[model samples]
Structure formats: structure tokens, C-alpha cells
Target chain A: MPQLDPTSFSPQLFWLAIAFILLYLLMSRLVLPRVGKVLGQREERIQGNLEKAVKLKAEAEEVLAAYQKSIADARAEAHSALNQAAAEIAAATAAREADFARKLAEQTAVAESRIKVSKTQALADIRTVAGDLAAAMTSKLTGVTVNGSDAGGAVEAVLKERA
Target chain B: MAAEHHSPLEQFRVEHIGGNLSLGGYDISFNNSALWMLIAVAAITVFMLVGIRKQAVVPGRWQALVEFLYDFVANMLKENVGNEGRKYFPWVFSIFMFVLFCNLFGLLPNSFTVTSHIIVTFALALMVFIIVTAIGFIRHGLHFLSFFVPKGAPAWLLPLMIPIEIISYFIRPMSLSVRLFANMVAGHVMLVVLGSFVLPLGLAGAYISGIVPVAAITAIIGLEFLIACLQAYVFTILTCIYLNDAVHMNH
Candidate 1:
């Protein structure tokens, strides 16, 4: 084959060295560095973005936790407020009921004392009338005079015997 | 037809560009092979330079292609040579891109295939071999010679195995060079031969018969393109494997 031709080998090698070395220099010095920089920049950017995303996510989670805690606190506060209001209302009602009961007892006691006084007066008036009536009847029936003190003494003895 | 008059090997003929230029008793004339190598280098330089001109974080199409190639070589080195390979990224990357571009460019009609020449491929292979061997020696000193001896073997078998090991180690450059050179030459020769058949077959019989060779040539051309890329990959990975062996010196 022409490739195996001995005379062609040197020239090929000579140019190969020249071309390849130049190419290598171009790559290592200029081309690769620029490409490498861009690639490295992209990777760094991606990594930075990912880290930022993670940080933001963590922050969001923290805020959510705080919000949840606040909600729980508010709920507890509302629950305590409701219980306190119920207790206060119950206490107020109990106090008003007790006051009303005390006032009712006082009014009942006054009414019972007034009824007792009126009954005693009514009994004394009845006793006086009966005594007078008894004296008059005695005088009319026997046609004899009866003394007031004697008639009172007779009514008193009859009342004592009946008691 | 003229197709039958032409030789398939004609394409590989190296013609001088001008008078020979020699230095130190050497003929270093610029030729077709040299011209293609320059073209390949120039093409790569332009491609990379233009690709990164914008340097946008969000890459355009060309930038994406450039980045893809960069990552491709980077990953290859990482996989083969580990972190230590980072230092050699430029060398490995240049080899891959140069070989790949040369192979692809050669597929163009009437273009020279630099890799098809034994001198070029052999030079690349020899450079790799020499460098790798030097690395082994430098890292391990004289202990690098122990690489040929099997770790666990019968004492009697050392007589038989050591030579085989040594021969295989020495055969690396030859194998690497021949594999790439043979593949390129075979593919191109097949394309030419198949293409040459179209005209002669047409003149011999029905014009419709020309379609057969034409279709075959088309198919082979596609296959050649795939092979070109594949050979470049094969060459690079093999270089990596050899480098790995030298760097790590595993049995």
C-alpha cells in the first residue's frame, strides 16, 4: 500500500508533529480553558441555585412551623376564653339566684309575722264581745244584776276549762 | 465507464502542495495529508472559539454541542483514569477531537484520511505507549518491570507466562495503530469499490441495475460514518485503558 511507502513516512511524521503540537497548544492554552471556564461556571451556577433552593425550602418550612405554632396558641387562647366566659356566667347566675332566694325568704318571714299579729287581735276582739254578750244574757234570763268583774271571772274560768 | 478506469486507492495518493521544504536533512513538504490535518485543527479551533463566544449559562445549539463534547471527554477520563486523569484531560480531549474530526472529514468525497495512514496512527499509538510506560516507570521505579510477572502462578509457569505478558505489553502500540488504520482503510476501500460498480454495471445491462450499487454505496457510507465515530471512540477508550494500566499497574 502507499501508506507503507518508506519515503512518505518522514514527511508525514514531520507534518503530523507540527500539526498535532499546534493543535494541542491551541486546545490546552486557548480552547480548553475557555470551554472549561464556561462549563465550570455552569456547574457552579447549578450548584449555587440548588443550594439556594434548599435554603429557601428550609426557610419556608420554618415559617410554616411558626405559623402552625401560632395557630395552636390562638386556638388554646380561644378555648380558655370560652371556658372562662362560661365560668363567669355560671358564677353570676348562681350569685343572682342566691340573692333572689335570700330576698324571697325575708319577704316570706315578714308576711308570716303580720298574719300572726292580725290573728291575735282578732281573737282578743272576739273574746271581749263574747264576754259582754254572756253578761247581758245572764241579766235577761234570771232578771238579776251581774257584775262586770264577776262575768269576766266566769268567762276566764270557762276559757281555762275549755283550754 | 471512467469508474472502472479509476483505482479505488487513488484517493490516498499524497501530492505535494509545492516544492519540498526540508529542515535538518528532512523532507517536510506540505502535502494533502498535512493540508487536511491543518484543516481539521482549524475547524476544531473555529468550532470551539465560536461556540463559547457568547458563553451563556443557558447554551445555544453550538454551545451545547461544545459542552457535550467537553463532558464526553471529561467523563471518559474520570471513568478510566479517575481523578488523576484530570491532569491529562487536554491531551486526551485533543486526541479524541482530532481523530474524530479527521475520520468524519475523511468521509467527505475526495478528502484525505489522515488516520488511514500507518505513520499517523502509529505515531499517536507510539506516543501513548511511550508516555504510559514512562509514567509506570516514574511512579513505580524499577518495580514497573514486575508488571509482566503474574501475581499468582506456579513457579514453573513463570517461564511460559512472563514472555507472553511482555510480548502482549509490547504489542499495544502495534495493535492500537493497526486497528484504527485498518478500519479506516477498509471502510473507505469498500465505499470506493461499491461506488465504482455503479457505472460499469449500468453500461453492462439495464440502467435500473445501477441503483443497486448506488443504494449499497449509500448504505456503506452511512455505516462508514458510524464506524468513523466508533473508531475514534475505540481508539480513545483503548488509550484510556492503557493509561489506566500504566497509572494503576493492576495485574
Candidate 2:
């Protein structure tokens, strides 16, 4: 086989060097930046999503707390209203009962007074009729003048003897 | 193997130059290897320039094909190097394209495989080694030397450890060049030897014997084509890994 050596400082090394430099430039200036940009974009997107999730979670917790508080306030208000209504009903019923009892007592007292006045008037009318009958009998029998007072006393004495 | 006819290597033989020029030291004789190298370089330049000359948004077939290769190498760099290390894409891309073109050009009928030569492959490997080393030193200086030292080794094992590191470092270029050259040479030789047998076997035997050599040649040629692409890929990827080691020094 023949020896396979090239002359030193040939165009071969120059071409190789040129190619290497060109390759290095293309990589550094063009290709590398695109790749790096893509990766950086991806990382930013992931981090943004994470932060959004955290914010949403905080907002949800706040809403839940507010809802719970409102429900508790409503329940307390309902209980207070129910208590007030019950107390009002009890007071009204007690007042009605007291009024009814007072009216009944006044009606009973008026009836009892009317019965006593009627009985007194009836007894007075009976006494006058008896006195008139005594006076007429004394005048006829004695054929003499008799006083009104003497007649009245004789009638009362006769009635007492008959009882 | 037979004296009846010539071998395929005959075409690649170096002939003596009888020119009167006093360029004594200059081996003005052109061989198969040099022809293929020029062809590879031309093929790459023409393919890329022609493919993107139109610069169409919706690219043609040639443009699409070229673009695919571009994107492929770009993605390979990004995947290996990560975000911070993506700055070296141009160097990696050019290496991949040039090597790929060289390997593919050799696959053509009667074309020489320059990568099959150890000197050519060594030059490629040497460039990678030198560039990566320089980059490492520039980036980390003496700190880059720490890449050779294993973190978990015992103090007593420094003697064994240091030698292993040195050997491993030296073997990088050797392994890188040899792997490419050997694979390319072996594939080409197999195809040529098998193809030569086809003609000799055809003339000496019955017509039916032609089928065997034909089938074998076809299979070997197909495998060679595949290998051409694979060897280029292997060469490019290894260079990337070596560059990564220099840049990051992860170990």
C-alpha cells in the first residue's frame, strides 16, 4: 500500500477550521436561542398555572367561609324571632284571661244588688196593705174616733198573735 | 479471492503522478477518498441551499426533507443539553449535517468512503476533542479537571482512580474515530466483496446460482445503506455527549 499523507498546511485544515467556525456561529447565534426560549416559555407556563391554582383555592376558601357565616346568622335570627313571637302570644293570652275574669265578677255583683232591692220593695207594699185593713176594722167596731197610730199598733199586734 | 478478475478495491487505488511540477512533497495524485470527500461537501451545500432557496412557508419535498434533518438535530441537542446548554446548537447541527452528508455520499455506486480512512475520522474526532477541551477550560479552568475525579472514592484508592480517569479521557477520541471508521469500512467492504462474487459465480455455474448472489448482494447493499445513516448518527451523538461532558462536567 502507498503512503497516505497530505502536505502540511494544506487547504484541508483551512476548510476544516472554516467549517468548525461556521458551525459554532450557527449554533451560538441561531439554534441555541430558539431552544432556550422554548424551554423558558414552558417553565413560565407551568409556574403561572401553579400560582393561578393557589389563587383559586384561596378564593374558594373565602367564599365558603362567607357562606357558613351567613347561614349561622340566619339561624340565630330565626331563633330570636321565634322566641319573641312565643313571648308575645303568652302575654296577649294572659291579658285576655284577666279581662274575662274581671267582667264575670262585675256581672255577678250587679245581679245580687238587683235581687236585694226588689225584696225590700215587696215587703214595704205588704206592710201598707195590712195597716189599712187594721184601721178600717177598729173604726167600725167601736163606732168611736180612733187615731191612725192606735189602729196601726192594733193591726201589728193582731198579726203577731196569728203568726 | 480468484485470479480471473479484479477486486472492487482496484478502483480506489492511488496512481503515481508523472507531472513536471517541482511540487515534490505534494502527493498530487487524486484517490477515491478525496473524490468522495469533495462530493460529500458539495452534496451537503447544494442540498441545503437548494432546499431552502425558495424559503416557502409550505415547503416542497426537498425543503421538507432538509428541514426535517435540521429539526431532528436541533431537537437532539435540546434534549441532551437542557435549556442552559442549548447555546451550542449551531456547532452540533453543522457537525451532524456534514458527517451525515459524507456518509451518505459514500453509499452511491463507485463512490469512495472518506470516513473509512482512519486519518479523516481522526481529524473529525480531534476537532471535537480540542473544541470540547478548550470550552471546558474556558468555562471552568482548573475546576474542570475535577471532572476526572470521582466524588465517592476513598483517599487510599487515589493511585488507581487517577490512572483510570486518565485512560478514560485518552480513550474518548480513539473510541469516537475508530467506531465510525471501522463501521463504515466494514460495511463498504462487505458490500463490495459480496457484489464481486455475483459476477464470478454467474459465469461459472448454472443460471439458478445467480439468485443466491443476487439476493445476498441486495441484502448487504440495503444493510450498508442503513449503516451509512446509522454511523453518521452515532458519530454526531457521541460528539454531542463529549461536548456535554466538557460543558456541564456533571460527574
Candidate 3:
């Protein structure tokens, strides 16, 4: 085989050396750097994206917390408002009931006073009538005129004894 | 016509271009091997230059291919040589690309396989051997001599084991170079031998008798392509391993 032949060895080695060194320089100085730079840039971009995602997630959580806080505040406000409304209604009902009771009591007192006045008037009429009757009867029996004032005094004394 | 040139070995002949040129005693004349080497270098240079010209953050197809090769070599170095191997990335990468391209280009019609030549492979292997040995001595100083001493060997076994270790250590270049050269030579020889049958059979004879060799040639070509890539990988990883031994000084 010509490959086994010794004559071709030196030229092949010389060219191999030159080409290899040149290729090494090209790759190390130029090609590899460019490729490495691009890869590094991609890695940096992905890392930055991940960091942004985390930051955005934190911001979303903060917003969600604020939203939850507002909901709770509104719920508390609604509860207090409901409680205040309930208390006002209760107070109004109590005040209305108290006014109603006061007015009813005043009417009862007026009615009782009217009944007392009527009762006293009725007793006085009865007393006058009895006194008149007694004077008439006494005058008729005795065939003489009886004094009204004396009859009234005798009726009053009899009524007081009966009581 | 085919019977006249039946030697498959003829394909490996390195004919000098433009007569022989010698500088002092050295035969520095440009030859077929040199020409192919230049072609391989130019091809790689162009491929790299065009692929990386854009340097896009989002890589185009060519740029992606270039990046893929770069990362492949980088990862190989990192895996075999560790982080300290980062400094040797360019050399390892160059060797891998050069061997790979040379092997592939040799597959073309009438092209020379530079790696098939023992001299070329030996040169590469020798360079790696020298670099690794220098690194070993530089890192470990006189302790580098201890590399030939097997750990856990009894004092009486020293005489037996020491020579074996030393010989094995010295044989690294020969093994590395021969492994690549032999694989290339064998594959190319098979291809040429099988291919030689095709022309001799003629068209009518090919229909009658050439089917087997043709099919074999096709299959062997595919296998050769695989071997080309694998051999390149093997050569590079072995270099990394040797470098690792140097750096770590592990027996």
C-alpha cells in the first residue's frame, strides 16, 4: 500500500501541522468565541425571563392580598352597617312603643277622671231628689207646709247614718 | 481497462504536485495529501465563518450547526478532562473537526484519505503524547515518575510491573495513531476492493453478477461513514483521557 510507503510521510505531517494549527487558531480566536457568546446570551435571557416571572408572581400575590384585604374590609363595613341599622330599627321600635304606651296611659287617666266626675254628679242628684221627696211627703201627712232646708238637713243626716 | 489497474492500494498513492521541492534535506513539496488537507481546512474555515457570521441570539440553521459542534466538543472535554480541560478545548476541537472532515472528504471519488496514512495520524498522536507528558512532568515535577509505579503492588513485583507500565505508557501514541489509521485504511480498502468489481463486470455482467458487490459497497460505504465519525470521536476522547491522566496523574 502506498500508505505503507515511507516516501509520503514528511509532506503529510508538515501539511497536517500547518492545517491543524491554522484551524485551531481560527476556532479558538473566532468561531468558538462567537458560539460561546451566543450560548451565554441565551442562558442569560432565560435566566432573566425566569427572574421576571418570579417577580411578576410576587406582584400578583401582592395584588391578590390587597384584593382580599379590600373584600374583608368591605365585609366588615357591611356587617357594621347592618348592625347599626338593626340597632336603629330596634331603638325606633322601642321609642314608638314607649310613645304608644304613654299615650294609652294618658287616655286611661282621662277616662278615669271623666268616670269620677260623672259618678259624683250622679250621687249629688240622688241626694237632692231624696230630700225633695221627703219634704213633700211630710207636708202631705201633716196637712201643713214643711221647710225645704230642714227636710234637706234631715235627709243628709239619714244618708250619713246609712253610709 | 479495469484489469490493468486492479490494485486497490494504488488509490493511497501520494503523487507530488509540480515536481518535488526540497528545503535543505526536508521534502516539503506539495502533494495530494497536502492538497486534501488544505481543502479540508478551507472547507472548515468557510463553514465556520459563514455559520458564525451572523452570531444571532436566535441562531439560524448554519449557526445552530456550528454551535452544536462547539458544544459537542466542549462537553466532551468537560466530561473527560473536567473543568481544567477547558484550556485545551481549541486543540481538541481542531483535531476532531480536522479528522472528521478528512475522513468524510476521503469518501468522495478520487480523493485521498489523509488519516489513512500512519504518518499523519502518528504526528497527531505524537503531539498529544508530548503535550500530555509535558503536562504530567510540569504538574507533578519528579512525582511524574511515579506514574509508572502501580499502586498496591508489592515491593517484589516492582521489577515486573515497572517495565510493563513504562512500555504501556510509551505505547500510547502508537496505539492511538494505529487505531485511527488502521480503521481508515481497512474501510477504504474494502470500499476500493468492492468498487473495483463494479467496473470490471460491465453492464450485462453487472445485471448477472455485480448485484452482491454493489450492495456490499453500498452497505460498507454507510458503515465507513459511521466509522469515520466514531473514529474521530474515539481519537478525541482518548486525547482527553491522556490529558486527564496528565492533569490528575492517576495510575
Q: What TM-score, computed on C-alpha atoms, does each candidate reach? A: 0.90, 0.61, 0.83
Interface RMSD, prediction 2: 6.0
| Residue lDDT tens for model 3, B190-232 | 9888887776664657366777788999999999999999999
Worst 10 residues of 1 chain A by lDDT: A123-132
Q: DockQ values for all predictions?
A: 0.65, 0.09, 0.59
Give lDDT tens digits, candidate 2, residues B59-114: 67986686777778767766666665556666677677767777777787766566
The sequence of per-residue lDDT tens digits that candidate 2 reaches over residues A70-119 is 99999999999999999999999999998988888888888888878887
CA lDDT of every candidate: 0.91, 0.70, 0.89
Give DockQ: model 1.
Answer: 0.65
Better of 1 and 3 by TM-score: 1
Docking class of 3: medium
Off by over 4 Å in 2: A1-163, B1-5, B11-32, B54-60
Ranking by lDDT: 1, 3, 2
The better candidate by TM-score, 2 or 3, is: 3
Top DockQ hit? 1
Task: Write one digit per residue (lDDT tens) for candidate 3, span A113-154.
Answer: 999999999988877888888989988898777787788888
